[model samples]
Target: MSQTVNALEVKASPASNQTGYRSFELGSFAFSRDEYFAKVTWHVGGQKLSHVMSADAFLRAMMRDVAWGFFYGWVNFDPVIGTRNLYGKVELYAGAYHPAYKEKGLDLTETFDSREIMATFKAILDDWTNEGFDPFAAPDETDTTWVGKKNGNNRLAIERQRQACKRMPGLAGDAELRTDKNGYPVNRAFADVSQEEPEVHAEPGFEDEVHAFSLFAYLSRSDVTWNPSVSSVLERSLCCPTTEEYILPIKHGNDRVEWFIQLSDQIEWEIEDKQTGAPRAKVIMKAGDVAAMPADIRHQGYSKKRSMLLVWENATPGLPELYESGKLKPNPVEF
Candidate 1:
């Protein structure tokens, strides 16, 4: 007896409190409110296939998947589909098996048109909204299904591209270099030289302290290459295996102040009052947390993971510049 397979389906409804007609609508073929930014996997013929989501979420997820190696297509939104202003923009990135043309024996400057793929995606959207078909509906269970058939065709195109890459001599090397962490090796040659480090010492009375913060930035460029080495330079201010941290101290007439920003998991902090020697109020931060320290409040870093922090000081620009330049000594702080 053949086993019965439950087909997936998508259901759409008007957003709550929304009425009348608007220029555009925002809805997902397979996404639910509860699963916002969540991965939606599509399967056909018992084989897992493509996934899609918001562009920002997609970029981050894809980076996590390949450790930050992939190309993307420009987002083209259609007003006829269920997206409002700014909602039509969707980012399309390379799938894991997508061919890296430069990896094969292709010239770096060679270009391939992605017009057909874009058209197919647009057609899919048009069919969904026009036919009132559920976007979540499974394409088909067998190889003869629409999605399976298209995927099979796409796979062939991908394979042909892969072959082209293999035929090129320098192409494979270039592709490998593109995926390399250190970056592609420039062909420029030069004589080798050695360098020595200068001696450095910390003051006898100085104490080390840890601070934490978060980094939020947008990918201004399409080719976003995250270089761990470049990120290492920020270690002095932000320290984490995956993040960074820093410490800053302030002094006033006969008094001192410190502030800290701990960017990490959710937790509570406890400190001892210096003057009263009493338990201070507990500070709590949940996972995916960010907090700012008060100018008068002294804070300590505490997080399960290393955190990246950005510090904004109120000191004189000249003084801070001197400190950063290693001319002025950093005030000591005891944990």
Candidate 2:
């Protein structure tokens, strides 16, 4: 795992097309934005290839990429454009995994120091995101204000820290419980959800140790959708519950099996082979339904309404190596 650390820098320059807007260069990929679209261009062989995404979509995906430290593995911004985290480094690519580009040998991929790409992405998001538009929020909750010249910056929304708890919310010295005073007012879609905290009857020495809080009440106050927050942790296991609406921004390629428990409402998942992107199956999960996203496949979820999903993960070190080496099966169970 030895690697060299390069000097961190923002690889962006002022774009000629828009005032206050910047175009970025990261390795072989170039990112530029206009009023309505964010374009990523790269060269393959002798031709220039470009892929476009709505400014909002591009910003949202970039927000996650910056927030998650590039995430576990592949973070497909769309079917054609995204980044693959190599931990200390990142692979910025266009059409690297898409069938059309792969078959024709037109795909492009370039690796960069993780810090270098992250800084450039952060600069791009800050310059492109306008005021009143939150890239981290659900589409309906935000507006179409990204389709114009930069009006102002929404640093508060874009820079908010992802929730992570040492034990659980409400515990002493741990994360604070979400409250209206803390700017986490209950979301409109979850108005009917109960806001009661659980009462725990603890004996003698267990007063500080025993605790409980209403998970649904906490989730009802979530400001962002499709962003999983760590709610509970025990050694290598983590319980990450998130609210979901619309489509998941990225197609997550798992290095290990990820279990999902549908806490409320419903979601439909489209599964594909991890390497080929070939269709695997469509799974529709309702409240109380549970499913496992296998390590061998990539999957994306679609939610018609804001729904709660609990993602159970095994964070044991070297698990991916075990899976890749054939020492472990891609699935949780053979059946």
Candidate 3:
């Protein structure tokens, strides 16, 4: 069934209860925020259901959702409340596939145009985020002052674009080199990581075409965890290398096979069936280990120590439809 609809189903209301933070209604779900928490309220079968998240966490997750264009599949804000991307459409759900909520049949889901929720989410983030707090920064790197009313805006912090290069960093026509003035300093934990850049020897005419950058060195300065930055793009294939620490904020349900090349440290992944949330397997990947997350399942990562990961994805349009139609296998290898 097509989830796409012609008209927007979301409605924006004035500041909720004089807090000056606007409340939003997307179909049946109502979103409101106070000083410290973001609340979602809805009615299901005569029962009023509610879900809440820390304002910081809500803003963090929503920032990614808005930035990634809603991402490929499920972007679970918590285990209970989140969204699923249907490309042009989105599914806003509370407890839809979560085992505890699903078992009790209390799950509620509403589909909306991708633009509808995207706009509402962006507004919510803008209103709730304060001047001093940065939702994108790691907990230790940023302040814990997300409480109280909005004072000023952090557009520079929240709106920072993930690095995406046409060819390579430092190349004349490609992405620029990250510098100290650029605010991408080496993370404290990654102090031992080298700051060396790769030297490329190319044919006389291929100086611009042949280039290289140290992926480890580039990733050592990352300020955010579990967020992938596109280091290189070749057609539909993307090499997204990211720094990882702590738990992945969301359980990502893939619409296509995602390959992981563990570059440093270790990450233990909790894999579950995409539709049912049933246990599938536990994968512990150490340095130099590689794994493939099938499109048919959802997975979340746990990194005890700071680590580096290379996430390779195929961003070809309409790939999800091919997987759903059985025209393409969800797993990269059948055997």
Candidate 4:
């Protein structure tokens, strides 16, 4: 059974009231829309596979999977299909075992009816080839902007700024500001490093009193556990947090370096070679420890207690090309 089947069976139209709903009308197949999900029945190689999944999830997954396929030369559909349970195993039997099954990755032929899916993914590849998008970037940034801020395309690709976490205090040096019990601004709140005035003195220059500021205070303030919240953004790089009991998902195979600072507690990370899926390293980061992840790896983290994790990312636009072209070393500080 040739895996070349047209699986997108366009059937129905969704109501107009649903917000942010889009039907796939790209390539030879159009979407068969429903109220909340997409019902696509693709006919490939004289076989039919019907899959119904949430519209938003499907689109996000498809785009991410296709993008991964472009960069890594393969994509895993089993994680998507197995977790989502949209299409049954029997429906995908014909396309499951393919010669192009490059790695232990999922079979992409299991989704599409024809080879046109390749073309769609290729379109995504074209962007990364030049004006590339960073899929592993935070939700606030995903698409690579080809033009300046004035471009409408750039506006469309923008993400909503996160509001939940703590913002950075514009202090050039540590202990520069002082605070009272009520977090009120004052001149002399604490002693400085000089230790002449008192045990804790204000950092030089002009000191200002702050109401209250502490890492323990910040970690205590967060009630939600396990989910990452953005804490601060320093230019294009910033730290987001995860108050974790378990671990975070390895979203996309990142093609660039990302730094991790264990602000408090510990996290055990299992890093694997991105392309080959081989174990590269196992690391344990304790409090105040920092680790830099290289581009050629995929990693996941586990924490025993509800711990604080500071995820630092480099949002430099041209970094991907720099690393891919061997212009920059994967390790920022070369030993």
Candidate 5:
């Protein structure tokens, strides 16, 4: 068989909307936040097919399908919830469909090149990137430990963990040190966690008075996506956690409830239904702002600049079951 026989071409149709709608060969999908629901319309071969969906659900599905096609040469939507309301998942799995039903979304499924589909997917992402619309992302910039290159306007120096927690196996120990690219300590103040005990700062003349705590020291060294704990408040409550910029692509609601206290800068959060990935709200939080993450939904964050975020967690082991059993509401406060 000749490879040329399995070629595919894709481009955005003229119906594509700049902010709300994205057009594809088979259909167009709407991405509006204010709207309660999203819609996908199929305009192929004079046949019209359409599906209405929750906005969050659509975004999650769209992002996944596009990513799969672009990066893997095929698009699969099986993992998305609330999908039974839409067209069947576009896939060619073993014994999934009859020969006649093989081509539903793609015009020529048997002969279509995943690479060609990938190219089309890239086109869509490139357009979104240029327009400053990033909803799906998790780059290499995220670091739980303060270890990465500190670029312009970044001013902070901190120590790394000294050793793995005696309790948790496979966790990082204090080994990373403040060093130049050539592996030398950038300053005398820079030391490894293994080299020193936690400290507070004060001048020699003010030995008895403390100026600041070691938490600040750790903040100075973190990269864009850092999120780590520094304080244990109780059997289940936690504090002294911070998040770096460059948000993760997926939402996290695996836990029952999470807390956020804006330490510095601002972030735009996209909240969605956890099970269905349906859009619920968009929250803008700045320094001193606090928000509670409920168990019923997932949340994603967007930071325009390098910022510091303080997060608190409820580590109680049974919190999830309580929320699921309806004994506890997703919201912590009662109206």
Candidate 6:
């Protein structure tokens, strides 16, 4: 039996504000609707980029950004809740979809089509400009404060689990650390790659803090099962209420591999490396944005005026168990 998939259908119309933006179809089914969304940011080198994508386009772009190294973020409207939103999630593969992959690497043809991806992206932009929605006017902060604290609790539990797992024998391996062209520590862990490059920092007084949690889950693509676990230990970690701050230090051979799952409305920040004295990069994240930082990279947290996030992690086997032991570091930073 053949399985049915949704088709790409789009309709573009001039926006009511006369700003030259257009409205587009939001979803393939009747219950779905398009909402206003925007992603704008400036990199450390001073390059500006922006994109207006629907929720779906925002996801795909984020996937691409993690696969290829680039500044990709977004701000979106949630019609169901009547609010503007912000979010960020890390992509594990920094070069997941490189040109080299087209001929010599993972075959994405069966899983993703360029045309469909573009259609989704266009629809998001069109809906924002023409749908009479605002991406900045979120609800009052007081109404959403409780949800934020709840998410913080969830984040903390996941990190404690990872800290415990680090102690098991055979859980630690050479693969945990990212190596350079000559095979040296690339900023302690693979997650820190973005921090070493001068082009990925944030604003002044904003230092980057690592998300101690790691995120690893399965997204069923049309062709294959994308599993990050085969390569690294930290599989899927969530960033909800339990986590506050994470630190990814310069590699000295004793760092752990950590990742973060940035759920809806939570903000992950970026900034310059304090030790290196590099200039900061500009970050503009909207609702539905996902980005990843290497272990050495620094990032912080930005909560929505009202909302919750689910962060996931996949850590080296014995690390989680170690946190339960007395050896775990005290008062780890929160994001």
lDDT-wise, the better of 4 and 6 is 4
User: Evaluated with lDDT, which candidate comes out highest?
Assistant: 2
Tens-place lDDT digits, model 1, residues 1-335: 11111221223333323221011111212322111222333333355433345432322222222221111111111100111011123323222112332133221111222332223232223222212111211112112222211111122211111101121112223212121143322111101111122233536543121211112210011022111111112223322122221211110110122233433333344443322213455566554454443222223334332223322223232432354455544444434
What's the TM for model 6? 0.21
lDDT at position 105, candidate 5 = 40
Which candidate model has the greater TM-score, 2 or 4? Answer: 2
lDDT of 3 by residue, 1-335 (tens): 01222353445665556566667777788888888888999888889999898888888888878877888888888778889999889999999988887888889999988888887777667767888888777777677778876566777777777777775667787777676888888898799999988778999999778878877888998877877888878888999888888777678889888999999999999999887778899999999999999999988888888899999989999888889899999888966
Query: Could you list the CA RMSD of all candidates, in the order they appear?
Result: 24.1, 3.4, 4.1, 14.3, 14.4, 22.1
Candidate 1 root-mean-square deviation in Å: 24.1
In Å, residue 118's CA in model 3 sits off its true spot by 1.2
Cα-based lDDT at residue 217, candidate 6: 12
Clashes of each: 18, 0, 0, 22, 10, 82
Off by over 4 Å in 3: 1-13, 16-20, 99-105, 148-151
Q: Between candidates 2 and 5, name the one with more favorable lDDT.
A: 2
* Per-residue alpha-carbon lDDT of candidate 6 for residues 274-311, written as tens digits (9 for 90 to 100): 22213355343444554433323223344432222233
Q: How should the candidates be ordered by TM-score, best one leading? A: 2, 3, 4, 5, 6, 1
Compute the lDDT for candidate 6.
Answer: 0.27
lDDT to native, each model:
0.24, 0.86, 0.83, 0.44, 0.43, 0.27
Tell me how far the alpha carbon of residue 182 in candidate 5 is from the true structure, in angstroms, after superposition: 14
List the lowest-lDDT window of 10 residues for candidate 2.
1-10
Instruction: Looking at model 6, report the run of 10 residues with the lowest lDDT sum.
Output: 218-227
TM-score of 2: 0.94
